[model samples]
Target: MSSTQPVESEWDGAKYGREESTGVIFGMEADQVIFIAVGVVLGVLVVMINGFPWGLAAAIGLLIVFGGIGIPRIKGNSLIGWARIFFRSKSRQRSGNDQFVQKDDGVEIGFTDDGEVEIVEGPEFEIMDGSVRRGDDTPRDGKNRIRPGKPVRMSLPGEFGELLVYQLPGGGAFIYDPVLKVATMVAEVMTEKAFQLNSFEEKEDRLREWVSVQSTIARIPGVDIVQLSDQTTMISGASIRHWYEEQILKAPAVTTADGETVRQAGPDVDPFMHQSLVETIMSVENQPVHDMWMAVVLSKEKLNERIVAAGGGVAGFMETALSMMGTIENAIPTSGAYVTKWHSPHTLAARTRTAFDPDSAIQVSERGEDGVAVRQAGPMYAAPRDIKTYESDGALHRTYKIAEWPHSQARLGFLDKLVFAGDFRHTVSLYIKPRDTAKALKANERDRATWSSNDKIRDKIGKQQTARKERQIQDLVQEEDEVTAGHAPLKLICVITVTAETDRELNANCADLETRAAEANLDLRVLYGQAEEGFIAGALPFGKLEV
Candidate 1:
């Protein structure tokens, strides 16, 4: 076998490390030095003329020479020198090699083949003979390996010409490049998809918790429990509806079966029927299930129309319908019967009956000692003018009467007001009894004679009373306007009572309910007695409550 001599490879130090060389001061080459010196001299001359208190003539002459000639050359040289320095330094630093050694201490020494070095200490270091040094440890720890296919860039420190060497992983380094560091950070963050998974899991847990709370609250008896927020709850029930109906029944123009009008004792009739109808329609459109009472109301054609209108289209319709049903089911009507006249335009007369009775009634008393017609009237009796009559120009006579009318003037006045107001669009009432033409004729005759004799007196008295009433009404209207106009009034907001097992349990239940409501995008409010004095009463943006 022929022995081949091993060729000794040249130890090319240049290939292993960056070259360091000294030239003119501050690392500037000879040509740069010359340019810089010239620039400094020109700058000094200009400064002397502008800043110094030289004689005006000398200053003027210097300014002309420097400003017209010297300044341009100086500036040109300065710019050239700067360019040379920047390019040269950048090129040299970029050309530098990197030396990464895996020390026996499980640390690594990373140095630019130039002169700068970085000491990285850890068990993560790994060496690849003559190729590269890498941190083999997991990325989650502090491994310092650049990803493949990326380039390394270098940057030089200001005023020192010292380079801050960076490893552009796939290629080389450039001066002042931050691209490498930014890329590395992004790569690290991208590896953390596990964190995103954890976040999603947590969110799902919260949602599940909210659903459970909603299910719990829905089971409460007699209470229409609603979740208003994460920390608020609303407890409502059938009593609310009862209150609204009561208000409607008490409205000023309501009439009884006997053609007797009654005034509502409180505020205007509750406007909730229309509102409730609207809500019920909306709920039907949206939810699969609805409150029982709401379904009953929506069964009416007129009510359903109002609901559809209020809800706009399907989504609005669904929301309103569900809310109305919920509210109505929970509401309870007051303990009273509603009596309204059933009128048929096709018929001459309509009638209705009520449980209400006058405090007293007219009855003939047993024969007294005097044997005279003893007028025994109860607390209530017929009015004298209940019978009315008039004669037409062509006809012999005409007559009208309200038989067995109530005795009270207040009651009579109330009935009269309802008639004059004509608020009930579809119906009217009348008292009914057997007609007595003779009695009516007698009364008419007496009235005719009295009126013929005292026309002036009657007109004067009527005028005075009318004027007084008109003035009183005007004052009342003005006062009402003023009270309502300038500022918000102190409204007596309605109260809602929720019966719970206990105060503590109620609060806890409310908190949970509110959480569910928030998830459903519902607004819920919870007011403890402490938030305000006495029972809590308030209004919501979309609905009103009356206790």
Candidate 2:
């Protein structure tokens, strides 16, 4: 179960997963090498046709312009790479995809048949005496005409649009998009024993169990794991006030000497004890609580066969999910966790509302359990951004991706510092995608070929490979061997999102976040120009990344 031994024998340890660079020759990317070769060939042709000095000067100019300016890395990407990103960002902006503005009128928020939001303008026909009438037109019964508007409904921007979320009967939720034909299962994960506090034997057992879980998940083709942590700070007296009120309600009535009924405000001897307790609690500082959720993302077609076999409706989907959930529930230990499934549509609405607008209070609806009015769940306003952070109602969010992980071996709970960094609101998410076994093996062989070619090029040029490159080669060889031995190949990405009510607070939290991540030996890069996508990937149980 253990791949890397612990530095100290008292703890369980594992090396961070590293992906080998696939440079073809002379430690340069394939594109770079191609450009250089093209320039050389052109210069040789010119020399054959013209003269030595002109061709040589042209060749030197091309080398200086292309190889000199484009080869060196800047902020983990080359100049050409940055140019590509810049053009992509500008293209998105020009297409009006970077910003979203909700329709001002409630009458224009209806959805078309294909799930696109329809915004139209027209004069209202007032209903009088049970009939809607227009000037000099025949009056028609209002009940007979289909209303062309959906109340307070608008589509979320980008990939979040056209989403439909359903609460399962037993537990968990199914978040799907009809247009995209993608489905995801989201479930909360209950707290488990602290890995750092466990004994050496317990640590080994835990690691073994985790390996088994990974193996089980890896067997599901085209699957990705999304683990999210939503940390909220409790600075208000709502909990204390609710407790005080509950105590007052539960206080037993006492009969006075005169046989009159008398009820105290609190259970204690002092009638105002609950009030005092509330005040004391309010005086203290805020506390942070973390909620963890794990989501499994899959293509809708993957589950279609099972759903059809089970009879193909809500019941059929539920049955299929229940069977699938058995493996997931056991692996993650979902007991005591709030699974987000509700028997009532009103509850689902409340959960959705809170998910999009954290500052908004959840209002209980009087609607029945039949179906949810999705309009009630969406946020009133959203300001999308192509930059670092965006506003979705009252909160500002900034997301960061783990550009570099710890190179040195550490304890099992090395991420605890980064997760529990500051007392501010934030979320830490991990996305794991298990690769297809055959494809992974083929890719590994191709990488070996590339490395061999690179080695030959380096030897011809009398340049020795760097120590880091040698280590990476050895690691790749070991990984290839492991895959041959039936170990699953996986790609993982870590995203962190920090949330705040204002800019100042958000900046302060982000600074603190960077410090904590550095302590954990993680290099965090802000997901600039992909803020909305990053927020969705990091802060929600939506299995997505900014690539």
Which candidate achieves the best TM-score against the true structure? 2
In the range 21-70, model 1's lDDT, one tens digit per residue, is 12233223456556556655665675676666554445566555543433
TM per prediction? 0.14, 0.75
Q: Candidate 2, clashing residue pairs?
A: none
lDDT of all the models against the reference? 0.26, 0.62
Q: Model 1 residue 383 lDDT?
A: 14
RMSD of each: 49.0, 8.9
Model 2 scores worst on lDDT over the 10 consecutive residues at 362-371
lDDT of 2 by residue, 1-547 (tens): 7699544552324466454456666556766677777767776776777678887777677667767765776656656666777777778788977665554344433334345665534322222333223233222235432122222232466657556544444424455555656656666564566667787676666766666667677776435554545544343345445555776777788888899776676544564775677777677544355656677776556667876776654345545665676666665442223343322223334434555566643122112122234444555666554367777878888989888788776656667877788887788887777888899889878877888888888899898888778867876787788789887787778888888888999999999999998898888888776677777778766666665
Residue 281 Cα positional deviation in candidate 2, in Å, after optimal superposition: 4.9
Quote the positional error of residue 269 for candidate 1 in Å.
99
